[model samples]
Each structure stands twice: as structure tokens, then as C-alpha cells.
Target chain A: AQTVTQSQPEMSVQEAETVTLSCTYDTSENNYYLFWYKQPPSRQMILVIRQEAYKQQNATENRFSVNFQKAAKSFSLKISDSQLGDTAMYFCAFMTHTGANSKLTFGKGITLSVRP
Target chain B: EPEVTQTPSHQVTQMGQEVILRCVPISNHLYFYWYRQILGQKVEFLVSFYNNEISEKSEIFDDQFSVERPDGSNFTLKIRSTKLEDSAMYFCASRGTSGGETQYFGPGTRLLVL
Candidate 1:
């Protein structure tokens, strides 16, 4: 079985500042996918970013990026130039590379608050 | 942009009662999944359905739980007997392609078993 761990239960960053949320996973499978999801007050789960294990290049989507260290089993999300809108609960999830029966294993999640 | 949708944004039911949660996955998606998040807890996988049958399920998805794709567009999760612990937010997701594609999630249906 695979497990995702978000060590930080809560995080805070000032507007225009940067914040990094840490995530680690335990998996024996060599190829897999990693994802970051955001849930705001609306209770909607939104996809923030994604990273593939085979690719060494980290994934970047505008203000959001991830530092994926495959060897260390670490995939951390970085929110640059954070804004108040970035406040939400962030989850780190893992899925096997196989397309069939792809079920996400999610972490406990970290609550991020951006202060003005 | 295409997206997954779930009905009954919130539901309140008594214990031992049956409840059916509905979902309409992306039109062309081949794989569908159901997950749950207990208040302040992690999102846990319940089951995954593909090709009209369940492809995988977790320990939490016991005999009391079942999934069905009754039609081309609708996928449903049925709980035979609701329990107090069953109160949680249920999310539906679908993948459009094979390989490691991203799974688009629905807004989620919050089920409260009394």
C-alpha cells in the first residue's frame, strides 16, 4: 500500500510572500504520479498542479510549482507571490503510473492561510 | 471546459437507511472514482469503476457499499445501510485518457448520517 504524508498541519504566508508545503510518500512502485489539490471555503476540490515520477523537471503553473525529489520520495508545493485567495486546505495525492484502476491516495492535508 | 458533476450537494439521513449518491463523469472519460473525506481528515479512496464494472476498491469500501454505472453518463454509489461514521463529503472523479492522466473532480456531495 502507498501512503502520502503532509508533515505540516498548518501554514501561513504574507501576501506577496512565498510559502512551501511539504509532502512525502511511501511507495514501492517506481513509476507513479503526484498531485496537489486545493479546497477552499466553497468545499470544491480543485486541481492545483501535478508531477510525474519519470520526469526530473518539476511542474510549474504560474504562481504554483513543485519540487519533486523522486529519490527522497518528496514532493513539495511552492506558492510564489502568494495572495489572500491562496488560503485553503492543500492536499498531496499519489497514484500509480498504470492507467487502470487509478485511485488517488491523499495526505492529511495542510491548511494554508495568506495574511494581508 | 468539461467537468465531473455530482447531485445532492448535501444529504441528511438516518442510520440504517439507504442513500444513493449520483455522479456524471466527463463524457469521454473511461475511468471513474469515488472518494470520501471525513471532517478534518484525509481524503480516502473508496472505489474505482471502469468498463461498467468496479476495477478496484479499498478496505473502507465494504459490502455495505457498491458502485454502479447505470448509464453512459451516470455513475452512482449506493450505501446499503448508513452509519454515523458514514457522514462525510463524497467526491467523484474521472480520467479522460489512459496512462497517467489527471483526474477531474466534482464539487462533492456532503452526506450526513444521523
Candidate 2:
């Protein structure tokens, strides 16, 4: 079974500052996908970013990027120039490259607060 | 971009009653999934549907729970004899055929069993 771990339960970042949420996973499969999801107070799960295990190159989307260390089994999300809207619960997820049958295994999630 | 959608933002039901949560996946997506998050817990996968059948399910998906894609756009999760533990936020997600396509999720439905 695959397990995702988010070591930080809560983190606060000053406005326009940078914050990184830590994540690690336990898996034996060499081929898989990792993801970061954000859930605001509205409770919508929004895809923040994704990284394919086969691709060593990190993935970035605007202010959100990931540092994926496949060999170390670590995938951390970095939010740069954070804004107030960045306050939310961030989840780290893992899924094998099982085509369409794969299901996501998620972490307990970290609550991020972007302070004004 | 098209988005997944779920109905009834909130529902309250008595214990032992049956509850059905509905979702409308992306029009062209072929794979669908259901997940739940209890208060302060991780989101857990319940089941996945592909080609009108269950492709994968977690151990938490017991006999009391079932899923059906009765029509082209609607995917539903039914819980029989709802217990207090069943109260949680239920989210529906869908994915395109591509191997690495990210699963798009809908705004979850909050179910409360009292």
C-alpha cells in the first residue's frame, strides 16, 4: 500500500513570501505520479501541480512548484509570492501509473495560512 | 475547461436511512472516482468507475456502499443504513484517458447522518 506523509500539520507565510510544505511517500513502484491539491474554505479540491515520477524535471504552475526527489521518496510543494488566497489546506497525493484505474492515496494535509 | 459537478451541497439524514450522492463528471472523461474526508482526516478513496463497472475500490468501500453510472453524465454513490461515521464530505472526481491526466474534482457534498 502507498502512503503519503505531510510532516507539517500547519504553516504560516507572510504575504508575498515563500512557503514550502513537506511531503514524503512510501511506495515500491518505480512508475507513479505525485500531486499537490489545495482546498480553500469553500472546500473545493483544486489541483495545484503534478509531477510524473519518470520526469526528473520539476513541475511549476505560476506561484506553485514542486521539488520532487523520487530517489528520496520526497515531494514537497513550494508556494512563492504567496497571496491571501493561498490560505488553504494542502494535500499531497500519490498514484501509480495504472492507466485509468489508478486511485489517489492522500496525506493528512497541512493547513497553510497566508498572513497579511 | 470543463469541470466536474456534484449536487446538494449539504444533506442531513437519520441513521439507518439510505443516502445517495450524485455527481456529473466531465462530459468526455472516461474514468470516475468517489472519495471522502472525515473531519480533520485525509481524503480516502472509496471507489473508481470505468466503462460502467468498478475498476478499483479501497477496503473502506464495504458491502454497504455501492456506485453506479446510471447514465452518460451521472455518477452516484449510495450508502445503505447510514451510520454516524458516514457523515463527511464526499467528493467526486474524473479523469481523461491520457495516462498522466490529472483527476478533476468537484466541490464536495457535505453529508450528515444523525
Per-candidate TM equals 0.97, 0.98
What candidate 1 gets wrong by more than 4 Å, as runs, is: B98-100
Per-residue lDDT tens digits for candidate 2, residues A1-116, read 89999989999999999999999999999989999999999989999999999998999999999999988999999999999999999999999955657899999999999999
Residue A3 lDDT in candidate 1: 94
What CAPRI-style quality would you assign to candidate 1?
medium
How does each model score on lDDT?
0.94, 0.93
Q: Tell me how large the interface RMSD of candidate 1 is.
A: 1.2
Compose the digit string of candidate 1's lDDT tens values, residues A1-116: 89999999999999999999999999999989999999998878999999999999999999999999999999999999999999999999999955668889999999999999
Looking at model 2, the pairs that clash are none
Give the lDDT of residue B65 in candidate 2.
98
The residue-level lDDT of candidate 2 at A61 comes to 98
TM-score of 1: 0.97
- Per-residue lDDT tens digits of candidate 2, residues B6-70? 99889999999999999999998898999999988999999998988999898989999999998
